[model samples]
Target: MSTPAAPALDSLDLALLQALADHPRVGDLELSRLLSVARATVQGRLRRLGEAGVIRGWSPELSAAAAGFDVAAFVSLEIAQGALDTVRDELLAIPGVVEAFVTTGTSDVLCRIAAASHAGLQGVLLDLNRSTSVVRSTSVMVLSTLIEPRLLPLLATTAAGREARAPAYR
Candidate 1:
C-alpha cells in the first residue's frame, strides 16, 4: 500500500521542531514552557509529527570517526544488468558499508564506507570487488567534510515559505 502524505507543518509546528532540535532531551513540560504552549499542545503536535514520519527516531546521532572508524570513502559501483537487489543485499552484509544509494548516471550504486585504516578500507574494497553482481567499482577517499549532515535549515526554509536564507555555518 502507498504511504499517506505527511501533514503540512504550520508556524507553530516549525517553532516546536526548532525548539526540539535545539534541546532534544528536554521534557515536554519544558518545551511547552519554552514555546509558550500548553503541555497537551506540545504532546499532541509531537504525536502528529511522529505519526506523519517527520520525526523518524529519537536515538542520538553517532560519529564514525569518534567511534574509531577513521577512514571514509564514497564508492561508485557499476553492477550487472538488473542486479540491484542482489548487490544491495551483498552490500548490506558488509558492516563497513554504512550507506548506499541507487542512482541514475555513470554508476548504478553509490556507497559510503567507513574503516579503521587504509588497509581496512582496502579489505572492504576487496570484499566489494568479490561480489559477482558488481561489474566495476570506483572510489574516492574523503579528506575532510565541509558540511556535516543538516536538516534544520531546510525545515526552517520550508516553514518560512522558502523565503528565509539559511544561516551561515559556524
Candidate 2:
C-alpha cells in the first residue's frame, strides 16, 4: 500500500532535496557529512520521503537526440467522440508517442513524441491515424529548447516559506 501523502515540506526536507539536486551522484553518507547530520538521519529522511511519495526514484535523463530520435513535436489530436479510451490505448501501442494528455482545446488529446526525421514523424502520424478514433491531428515541431527542466528553484522557494514559519529557537 502507498504511504499517506506528506504535508508541506519542512526546511530540512527542502535542504536534503536541494543537496541531492546539486550532487545527484553523492551517496547518503556524503550527504549527511555535507549537511552535518547523522548518516542514519539522512537514510531515514530519504526513506520517509520516498515512502510518502515526496521522493520519486532517480532515473537518468537521456536526450532524445542522443537516442537518434531528434525530431520532437507536440501533436494535438482531435479524437472522435466516445473513442478517447480507444485512441489513448492506440497511442500507447506506438513507441514514438512518448507522452499524451487529455487537454482542453480544439483537440481532445495532446502528445509529445520524437522521431528520427520528418519522414519518421509522418510515419508516426500515419500510424496514429490508422486508429479511426483519432479524427485529426496538428503537430508543432520544437525549434529549440531555451530552458531545460528544473524544479530546484521552486523547491527552494517552498523551503523559504517553511523557514518564515519556523520557531525562533529552531
Q: Candidate 1, 145: how far from true, in Å?
A: 1.2
In candidate 1, clashing pairs total 0
TM-score of each model, in listed order: 0.90, 0.87
Whole-model lDDT values for every prediction: 0.91, 0.87
Model 2 clashes, total count: 0
Cand. 1 Cα-lDDT = 0.91
Write model 1 residue lDDT over 1-170, tens digit each, in one string. 88979677777888898898889899999999999999999999999999999998899988999999989999999999999999989999999999999999999999999999999999999999999999999999999999998777777667677334446562
Q: Would you give me the overall lDDT of model 2?
A: 0.87
- How far residue 157's Cα lies from its native spot in candidate 2, in Å, is 2.6
Please list the residue runs of candidate 2 whose C-alpha ends up more than 4 Å from where it truly belongs after superposition. Answer: 1-6
Ten-residue stretch with the least lDDT total in model 2: 1-10
Q: Give the candidate number with the greatest TM-score.
A: 1
Write one digit per residue (lDDT tens) for candidate 2, span 1-170: 76575557767777898899889889999999889999999999999888877778888767898899999989999988899889878998998998999999799999998999999999998888788888888989988888987876777787788878788994
